[model samples]
Target: MTDRSHITLYSGGHKGAESEFGQLAEQWGIQEVNFSFDGHTSIQRTRGMKVLDPEELDKGNVSMEIVSARMGRKFAHANKIRKVIQSIFHMVNNGYHVLAVGWIQPDDTVKGGTGWGVELAKLFNRPVHVYDQERNGWFTWKDNAWTAEVPELDRDTFVGTGTRNLTAEGKQAIHDFFTRAFGPA
Candidate 1:
């Protein structure tokens, strides 16, 4: 009766390792949902703009489109929370079963990227699998801790797991996992 299906990958857009990881997820049944702020504009547009228009607060689609343009150099940080919420809702409403969040290290800045995925996992009650080269970590009352117990992802650089190193076997594993979690697609 339950039509559990589809896995979504939320990463720091499709660039560098993040982009590569998205491709790997595609190999599996997991669909990479590019929540990148860059989808709205071209690189040329992001050149010198400083701040996003306040009016964009109400017009997300238009604001986001402008943000995507490279002319402003507008980072995806300012409205990431809203963006993730929108992205999650959009995907889930459309029938995605699980979400695979991609993350990188150096989690201290304003828009630390992985934090969005982790937050979304908690928000959606989905189990989060984080793959990073700097050891696996989990939040705690005092501080987060790292260990070897976390699941190792395929090494597509983006996957950043010890076991899942972007190999054919690793890619297959991701596909199987997504299928099991989200159902067919």
Candidate 2:
């Protein structure tokens, strides 16, 4: 029997976001979709019975203008950040590690939820690992920033190079790293 590990993946639908993580997850038989519901965009692609419709949201009588105003921000997009936080908790409650898949820029900086999620994870004192495409290795929160040695990824803005896929070796490293982190499950 295969020891399948449940992990929450922080990434977008782009090739760069999903490439290495998706490959490694598949190789280790891990699942990225932790929560799925109707009209969740990914529901059709995933098998989930939990149904979620906007009827309740509509009933709340919340204005789209308000939503748009809050969701659209200069530095922090409320929707994405809030969703990332919520999903991080959801994944943790369901026994899944929060993994952020991102890239490192030529100048070395990370933005968006890929970077912000790690910040939130640190505040929550949770374990957050990243498959850094730029450095071509696995990183974890430790001390005050991302480190490849010891244990844990610390708080720091991840480097970025924009959306990009991982190489074959990078993908394998992801699998190996997770195995070491979780150990047989």
Candidate 3:
């Protein structure tokens, strides 16, 4: 078996996929880092939580207009969402592989801030995988398109982010993914 202890899961520690991923990582004896900031209160995973200061968060800052243009959606609360968008940057920047569970919009972006993380992964040319709940399958970004495939966590560090509304199927997929990568925990 692979030494899962060496693996580190970077995430936002949200209620849905990130929490599930963190739980699985703990079960598998893998390391986990859940990034957060001041005044943010929805975090579920406390282990390895690295709260970022204002300056640290600024390093990941980008114009909200650019984010809106890229995601094809407008943010009603730009100020509130800015911190989240910035925090996602640290997760994607620290991880080599990105695995997310969300709805992949027709616009080729995974919905919400999770999409921002996915976009960064693509920009960095890191391997990105998304398990679309609606599609009920995993799709990996390959050659400028999302192709169907069963992905393995070959890297020592990876980011896991997705929607807060976790589904039964989504949870199973995360479990199966961990099992496929590290065997029964």
Candidate 4:
């Protein structure tokens, strides 16, 4: 219990992660943040997504002349991304960790959440934990087993074991990952 206030649980925030984290957050008192776009916006930027000019998302404050075709559909995402970035800042400024758990794709690169979750964690000197849904276990940025070993991910090393559940043996794999990632020193 290291005052996980600064820790923002950054992840895909998928259903199981969300469900489990909700309970874990309540019991452990943790601040959590996630990147989400229901086929629209992203926390920062994504290809094919319509990037707003800040005014489009701010209807009440900044009036726009003509709403773009993508404005209305992307309004909620704009707001959501704003809040998530703000939360990341809060955790970083306050000195916290961001526990990242998300989908690991083939080719061994973070498809999307990697930038928001892994990159930020590295920048802020926080620990990041990744979950491999397909493998059903914890994985690091590097390991020969990784589908595509990333150099950036490999350059950094971990204080503890990177692969906690090699086989996805049990239901408590993620829980165990938290224990190793944020547990007492």
Every model: Cα RMSD to truth: 10.9, 7.5, 1.1, 11.5
Superposition TM-score, candidate 3 onto the true structure: 0.97
lDDT per residue (tens digit) for residues 1-185 in model 3: 56778889999999999999999999999999999999999999999999999999999999999999888999999999999999999999999989999999998999988899999899999999999999999999999999988778777899989999889999999999998888888
For model 2, the superposed segments whose C-alpha errors exceed 4 Å read 2-33, 42-85, 92-96, 104-110, 150-169, 178-185
In Å, residue 115's CA in model 4 sits off its true spot by 4.3
* TM-scores of the candidates in the order shown: 0.38, 0.52, 0.97, 0.41
State the displacement of the C-alpha of residue 155, model 1, in Å, after optimal TM-score superposition: 21
lDDT of 4 at 28: 55
lDDT agreement with native, every candidate: 0.35, 0.44, 0.93, 0.38
Expressed as tens digits, the lDDT of each residue in 1-185 for candidate 4 is: 46766444433233444435434543555554433334443232121122333343332222221111212222345544553333333333333333334555554443342234444454556544456556565554433343331111222122111122233332365456545555632
Q: Predictions ranked by TM-score, top down?
A: 3, 2, 4, 1
Model 2 scores a TM of 0.52
How many Å off is the CA of 137 in candidate 4?
Answer: 1.8
Candidate 1 lDDT, tens digit per residue, 1-185?
23322434444332333444455455554544443242334111121122223343233332444333312234556565455334433332332222232233353211243343344333454434543333333221112432323343232222211221233443444445445443564
Q: What is the lDDT of candidate 4?
A: 0.38
Regions more than 4 Å wrong, model 1: 1-13, 26-39, 42-85, 88-111, 136-185
Backbone clashes in model 4, listed as residue pairs: 6-96, 7-97, 107-148, 108-148
Residue-pair clashes per candidate:
21, 16, 0, 4
lDDT of 3 at 79: 97
lDDT of 2 by residue, 101-135 (tens): 56533333344435444444555566666667667
